[model samples]
Target chain A: MRSRALALPMAAVLALSACTGALSDTGSLLGRDTLRIGVKADQPGLGLRGPSGEFTGFDVDVALDIAERLGVEPADVEFVEVTSAEREEALREGRVDMVVATYSITPARKTEVTFAGPYYVAHQDILVRADERSIDDVRDLAGRRLCQGEGSNSATRVIGERGVAARLIEAPTYSECVTMLEEGEVDAVSTDDLILAGFLLRSRDAFRIVNAPFTDEKYGVGVAEGDLSGCEAVNRAITDMYQDGTAEALLRMWFGDTGLDLVTSVPQFEGCS
Target chain B: MTAEAPPRPDRPTARSRAAERARRAAGRTTVRVWTLTAACLVGIAVLFAVTTGAIAQARDGFQVIGHGAGPKVAATADLYFALSDMDAQVANVLLMGDEHDLGAGREEALRRYEQRRDDADSALLHAAQLAEGDDAEQENVRAVLDGLGDYEQLVAEARLLNDEAGGGAGQPPAAVVDRYREATDLMRLELLPKAYNLTLESGATVRATYEDRRSATRLGPVWVALSGAAAAGALIALQLYLSARFRRRYNPALVVATAGVVGLVGLATLMLDDQAQQLRTAKEDGLDSVLALSRARAISTNMNADQSRWLLDPERADTYAQGFLEDAQTVLYVEDAAGEVPGDLAGYGAEVDDAVTERGGYRGRMLGFLGEEVRDAPLAGQAAAQQEVLRAYDGFLRADRDMRLIAESGREREAVSAHMGGAGSVEDAFDRYEEALIELTDLHRDTFDEAVRAGDDGAAGWDVLLPAACLAFAVLVLAGVRPRLAEYR
Candidate 1:
């Protein structure tokens, strides 16, 4: 009789464990028919949320492909605008199912949320005015004004880690940084090469990106913390996107005209752990 | 006397001594009379100078403050309104999409936009002229003009894209929307704020000048009265001395001289007092109301643009709605005591409607331009005109709510149509409101013009009359004492 009672308790414990396993960090996302993907709204060719309530860009297309593989239609996907600072918060609050914005994967961020794949690796570069001849490299930014977009560590990385000693000027976004550069308010803007390339498409004669590369910014798909299934799903979808040649096509469509070397092969995925 | 005259030495005589004493007395009397006459003439001269100077100052104030910066500042107000309307027309044109005949249509919208642009340019020119001496203001004007150029380019690009997309009966494609967003953002962020700053700087100047000029005008009467009293007093004193010394009840010339001095001084005092009153009317009843109404018109125009923006872009509808509510609050804020007021048009509409329905009449719970207009109606019929404005404004609020409701219920085209179309639309209601406001503004403007004209008239002829009166007063003073002095001779 004691064995019988113990077996019943053991069965209940096993059932509860199974239930807990099923309800994961991404339970809300995978179970839902619609996927809400966070994206940048102002970035011209990366993930610009256009005026007619539609999203277009490399990040946007990548997000849609991942959503499609996860059994969500393009029409069922909703694009939520997120800044670099709010990506983690948006995932934590379930405001977005996944963030496919230009979110870079790092050890510090990995502790907060699970990153799926590098998807694309972009190097940090400097953008200066067309007439600028003094600044050709990251090291040359010493004592010159550099734009620091809000919630971005690019300017600080150049000034702090690289020991550039550049005077940091602040703006809310990369778009404003470009405006400031055009207005001669700032000497240079440093960020991911892809973002600069997007802006360079508009006014090639006004601004030129300095080809000097510094830091490697591994762009990742962010899901909620401990959402191992969601992370694996995104990584698999990203691999398919590359294998099916959709990645190269989307990159060509958005950033082909810009003279940046396009990397089309499947990027090494960050571990779902 | 006979004994005195009997034996007179050749050296001295009593009659000769008496004659010498009489001659000395007559000389002293003549000198005293002349001295009093000169004092009276000096008093009259002071009165003339003070009166004429005050009048001249009043006339100068009217020319400089009333006609100079006053109209220029008013032009700035027009610029603010025109900038807002231009943006509104842009939104309306986009809302028309591929269809050209929707509501007032794209062509009509474009025509209005062009007209507003021209108006804006004209205003900028005026602002530039007004800002000629101020380097900082001149820089601001240049910046605004540059910003406007950029804004227009963006708008033109948006229109071209919209036409190319040919999206039927709704919002154009994403590209067009993005371009339009960029244009509107430029207008709102850079252009509108800078324009408003120009207005504020110019408005402050107007207010400061009004205060200075008004104070000068107000104190004019007191100064004139004091000098006039001195002149009249001196004249009366001279007349009394002449009458008593000459052993006559009155000297006709001196009496006439005293009357003339009192009459002229009284006339000068009355003229100054009336001019002061007119200036006060101009500032308090006119310019203040005109400024408030101008701000109201500009804000309402922006609010209407927000409505069109809400319809044009569904993605940012809530943002535009929030902006509309904020601007609406600025135009007419109703105070809520319970702290339960929601920060949305729904809640605000309820509050305003409830206030309007209150039986005891407007309990002064309302604030903002509208409230100020009603509370401070200085002229006759102004209060009634303000009431009509309030009524028309209520109609506009209702129409806006209805348009939003239709849009929310998935009838966006109907909503857009109602916004841009004929009678009973939001446009119609807004037009009514604007008309009422314009009527009230005209009343104030008319008062200002009248005050300026009357103020000029009050000081008229005083320049020549002052010197002429002074000269005549001097002549009359000489004439009044001439006979008395001749007695001593």
Candidate 2:
């Protein structure tokens, strides 16, 4: 009877030992089969959801490619609508696997997650009514009302760093910024050069980008912390795409005569430190 | 012999006495041995539990450091690079946009701006990915991209207007220039910051992650060491008890159990030690070194871009470039004087000085080149200097491109420019600058990788050791327990 009693405890101990081994397995953490990606739903040429609810854009294409590489089919991937303010939080809290949003890589963001690729490049520029010829430089907007997304780096640069004493009007989206400019609610809208090109093309005679840009903004793919393997894989894919002329082809397709140039032949990994 | 023995009334029968003594001794030893074995078994189990806990803690520590803090640092570095690239592109675009010369000079500037624009967009995309929040940030980014598209279209129209007005004549109409200026101003004032904040958002997240990872990883090792000691102690006690009870020097079961506990404890300790060492090295070499070098490179890029812009419109561009240079100098000073240059900056001090001297020489030559032109005559020599600058910039860019290629290809060259001296017809001076930056980036990367490897290696070692120790302690306990069964039998 005593021996039997001891055997029960011994079995319990062995069971517990097995549990420890299972607990130590790191593979479970890596199993992110169905990934949720945060991306822009409005920006044409970069990221926009179609009528069929399929996301497409230069940035979207890159994101999709990355998903495909991760063994997830395009249909299996879920797209989460995201904005500049929400992207970081969504990524940090595990709400999304990656953000393919036309997000700019900056010193402030390196603190949150691992970033891969400078998939696209753009410059911050001003958009104005085509006929209006008064404003010549960022400095001339001292008294003009400038529209840009709130919490955006463009607003910060115009209102804070560049010291353009413009009446800073915050918009919810780039379209809103453009609308404000069109409606004369604001004198101008600030954003990336190629995006401004798309808007101007749509507007035709309505708006134009200023000759000078205020800043350069490089777009990257974001992954959760410690996901270096994922980061590396995505970076390699981007680099391969660049080398294979996939990036150039995509750029040509979206931005016809906007004259956007591809700077690096491969996507470079700028370590977050 | 015993059967033949006669009974003695005083001593009793020999066989009966011997049997009685043996029975009493056996009973006493059996009881004692069983108690000792039970105690040893309990000790071994407790030790194993403690050791296992310690090893688990060590693993957790490794995770926090490797996956958490390490990533945060890497991400932050990326953010800085992105922001710097953005700033540089903006400067370049503005410079290009300001150029009124409709010939080759104007086209070159536009081409350069377009290239820079592409770079900025790519950086922004990466930043967006790193940024956390919800769809709000993504929406904001999309909005900015749209706004920028509008801005570029406007610039293109203005460029066309200027070209028509120029008609290959002496100069374009001031009105056309004004139109171009207006378009350029709108884009710069309205659209640029929307993109820049994306970077700021990314930087903020990077800072938070770094702090969290650092704290979490720091606490893992102590827990592991304590648990390991407990397991080892239990195993030793079990072995002693088994030896004493068995009265035979070697108790196989007890020996196995003791060995198991000792092995487990030893392994756990080793793993913890290695991880701790790795974390320390990463902090000292990788994080710090990479941060400093990246900061310097970012600043330098920003300055160079501003310089390119200033060269386009000497009057206004110069001022902006000067401000950018000051900022760059500040970054350099912080990197150099803050004692963060990763080892002695003394060795590279001479090289840095030489680069600075070369920069000064170039500036002087540029000034003389510009002075020869009539100040009032439509900035004629600007085309020449613009071409020179373009050549130099492209040279630098090509070098940078090659360096990235080399790094990606895993070809570890001490200096980047060593391999690509013949790819382009670039000035040797510009090549040197590009090479220097590449070298700096590579040096820091190497240091960071070494630290990471150390940490990983340490964790791997611990992974092996902790399990071994647990098995050893278990064996020792089993060895100790087996002797008690013999006594019971």
How do the residues A77-125 of candidate 2 rate in per-residue lDDT, one tens digit apiece?
8888887778988887878888988787753365466777667657677
DockQ-based CAPRI category assigned to the predicted complex of candidate 2: incorrect
* Per-candidate iRMSD: 36.1, 15.1
DockQ of 1: 0.01
Residue A62 in model 1: shift from native, Å?
Answer: 46
Overall lDDT per candidate, in order of appearance: 0.78, 0.54
The model with the greatest TM-score is 1
Candidate 2: residue A191 lDDT (0-100) = 84
Model 2 interface root-mean-square deviation: 15.1
Clashes of each: 0, 143
**For residues B371-430, what per-residue lDDT tens digits would candidate 1 score against the true structure?**
656766668898788878888888888999999898889987788888878889998899
DockQ of every model listed? 0.01, 0.02
